[model samples]
Target: MYENYAQRLAVVYEATHKPEDFISADFEFKKMMRAGSCSAEDLRCYGILHHQMACYCIDKAVDLFDKVIGQGKAVDKDVFWRTKHQKMILYSQTGKAQKNIDEALAVINDGSEDAEDWICLIAAYSYSGDAAKAYEWILKAIPKFPDKAALYVYGGDTCRDLKKYDEAFKYWRKALELDDKMYDARYSMGFCYEELEEYGKAYDIWLDIARDLEEDGYEIEKQFPMELAEKCKAVLTDHPA
Candidate 1:
């Protein structure tokens, strides 16, 4: 029966990238678990499917996460960490910011303090409206992951959140220096320029971002660049260079 359902799941996977497709897969996995036929690998896949489903059905996602956690050491440690991380992110999105922050800190205390844990700490603090703590964690994270462009981008974001436009530009510029294709850093740099009234520079940066996103075939992600480009174009029209 599991083999038959697995074959059906392969067909569903090939046929759709839609979240609702996971509903059937989840049902099959639960049936296999009831029959005591599910493996650790199967539970890991179920957890990932739940994570995807969580984007649209968060309550069910949380329930599935709990089921994954109940598997204890049966679930791979990395998979367990990812499930907890997903829950933290979901909590933040659902306005349980403090809970997310507490859980993230607890995870750090439990000795999983890797680069991602630091990044999650920064995000949890930022979401909870504690910019100082967020900035501090970003600083700590930079030394740990010096080659990571995203960390510098997060640093720039923290600076921007605090209205430190010049500092934000410096951090974003550093991120771009590390990886020229860091689109979020480039976009934030343009935003910093706009805040500083450097309209021409902002326009140029945003135009380049739009071109880059289009060339990269990022259909959904291109909207951000396109909207920013239009805003910059409007500013340039108002104050021509």
Candidate 2:
């Protein structure tokens, strides 16, 4: 009862973005927790909710997330590592004065067996300014979770951020092989081609994706990266692919 009502308030708050609604939802969730009415999923939802609140309460939020994790509710879910990831961000934002980034990194290194956990490990390393370790973990994760398209997408994104444009393509290509309909991998690949000044390839990739989205009832102009693609009209004529 408390869980459903609290979630309803959360949903309404999400749609309205009203402070009162947010506060009401938070109050109700706290009430549920105090009453011992929360299930593991409820704890997870409350943890996420607390994270969304302002930074003034972030320490409390992180504690709540830790409690959620302690309940063994993390398998096949991003909440496990994402909590650590968010905690790392908090540490970084405070110049590591409040909490050590190593604390967050340690959690990620240990007890991370799932694919999402591996993804979190990559993010944890990435956020701690260890790009080499992050990239290395990506290599490790891909081999273990060969069919997981999202790992390829994340690996491609990390490589792209490192300015290894060509290497990023290899990841995105593998992602596409795993899931041909992954628009994000395709979009990132288009940008990689553009960065390499392979205009024709960019145009071809974007044009195909734009058409695909249109067929799927999405308005291309309102769909980011789709709109960016249309701006490459001149490339169609100049590169003539």
Best by lDDT: 1
CA lDDT, candidate 2, residue 175: 93
Q: Which runs of model 1 end up more than 4 angstroms from their true locations?
A: 1-56, 60-89
TM-scores for every predicted model: 0.63, 0.56
* Residue 48 miss distance in model 2 (angstroms): 28
> What's the CA RMSD of model 1 in angstroms?
12.4
lDDT of 1 at 35: 93
Taken over the whole model, the C-alpha lDDT of each candidate is 0.78, 0.74
Question: In candidate 2, how many Å is residue 233 off?
Answer: 1.9
lDDT of 2 by residue, 155-182 (tens): 8888988988778889999999988988
Over the full model, what C-alpha lDDT does candidate 1 score relative to the true structure?
0.78
For candidate 1, list the clashing residue pairs, or say none.
none
Per-residue lDDT tens digits for candidate 1, residues 177-219, read 9999998898788888888888778878877887888889876
